[model samples]
Target: MSEGEYRVAVRALCDFTAREGDLDHRFTPAPSAREGIAGHALVAGRRGEGYEAELPLSGRFAGLVVGGRADGYDPAANRLEEVKTHRGDLSRMAANQRALHWAQVRVYGALLCAERGLEGVTLALVYLEITTGRETLLTERASAAELTAFFEAQCRRFLAWAGQEAEHRLRRDAALRELAFPHAAFRPGQRELAEGVYKAAATGRCLLSQAPTGIGKTLGTLFPMLAAMPRRGLDRLAFLTMKTPGRRLALDTLAV
Candidate 1:
């Protein structure tokens, strides 16, 4: 959230930078979120007493804070795992998905080596079938240096894009700070609405406001919200409305 620093979960970092090939969903339907959680728990329960579940791992690379909880780790075996739950045939799973899975575990492996100061670790992909409660594990032994190099390579790829994003944000915030209300003066009761919106945004609080129609409510809300965005370091602002007319009003206000 800070300037020059981008915080990303290890899985997310892999999902963004390591994913390759076309997204194919031709295989059987994947397990549900709840099923995946339960599958992970079941797998952990089957592990030995020395096994550590949800082990926290993190590392820094090129101003990026990358962190995530590994599914399970065995100190005795020097093994780290990433558990994935699925349904149907494993062979039918898309190559791209499998590659992404490997990418995730490798990043986790890199972080684990850094965290524990290990020379190397066994990176594993344990795929569990929810319906049958069966597990198929695939593993590879990787040295600390190799994993670290892989992690940094991915970070370098992400850093180039992140630098562009940060520059865009800097320019956007500067523009927002310099923006002024379109009209010369606020309509009656509109100033109160604008002030309330600004306060809510600045303080990170919820505000419930009600105003009658035809009081310049659209502009009143949008202008102050835009003005407050830079102060709060907001990355995005979403204006939701119930109907098309409401959306049009908000867009029309922006045009003015």
Candidate 2:
């Protein structure tokens, strides 16, 4: 599983259900493991299937397999999801080592592709505990050739544990278990500002926002600004206020 081979069961469920020929979008855990992760993919929207999952290694190797599991997998969409229990906050991961976190899902994707003899696979890392009441999902793609190359490299480097994959998985797991939300719930109007900032950043548009006297304007402005700032090239982000009080307050908020 070269990099992130953690989602084998998802592919299996999709495979099994498809073989059943029911177009059974339902995901079911393989009668595979004794215990571990347990969730199913949403599958094909209304045609979705659900399932429980095991984390055991197939065709057996020497030691216990370190990481890999999918609570559920949706074949139609080629998506594999791993469920995590955490004090949810997606941005906390933005500063995380990207290669490592992405490796697991990419590897898992490779595994899924191998299982179904597929040419492509999609991986989703979902966190259910987010403050926004939304799951944090990260997606990636794996082509068969890519998966094969990755899996072969993983097998070669994995046992010796010389690659970034294992490290990436560990960091991701830790962040999920221990990382706190970088910012709390959006201020009363922060969500709107954040959305606007996100759109502006996404499309390279300019933005102008005003905060009257006392709302938490700094966060209201900066939170989304930070989130979208990276999406754009980030030449520089300036908060200019003519009023001493407003500028003082904005500068003070930046300390957070």
Which candidate should be chosen as best, given TM-score against the real structure?
A: 1
* Residue runs of model 1 more than 4 Å from their true location after superposition: 24-28
* Alpha-carbon lDDT, every model: 0.91, 0.51
How far off is model 1, as Cα RMSD?
1.4
Top lDDT prediction, candidate number: 1
Candidate 1 displacement at residue 194 in angstroms: 0.4
For candidate 1, write residues 136-175 as lDDT tens digits: 9999999999999999999999899888988898899999
Error of 1 at 142 (Å): 1.0
How accurate locally is residue 76 in candidate 2, as Cα lDDT from 0 to 100? 55
The TM-scores, one per candidate, come to: 0.96, 0.38
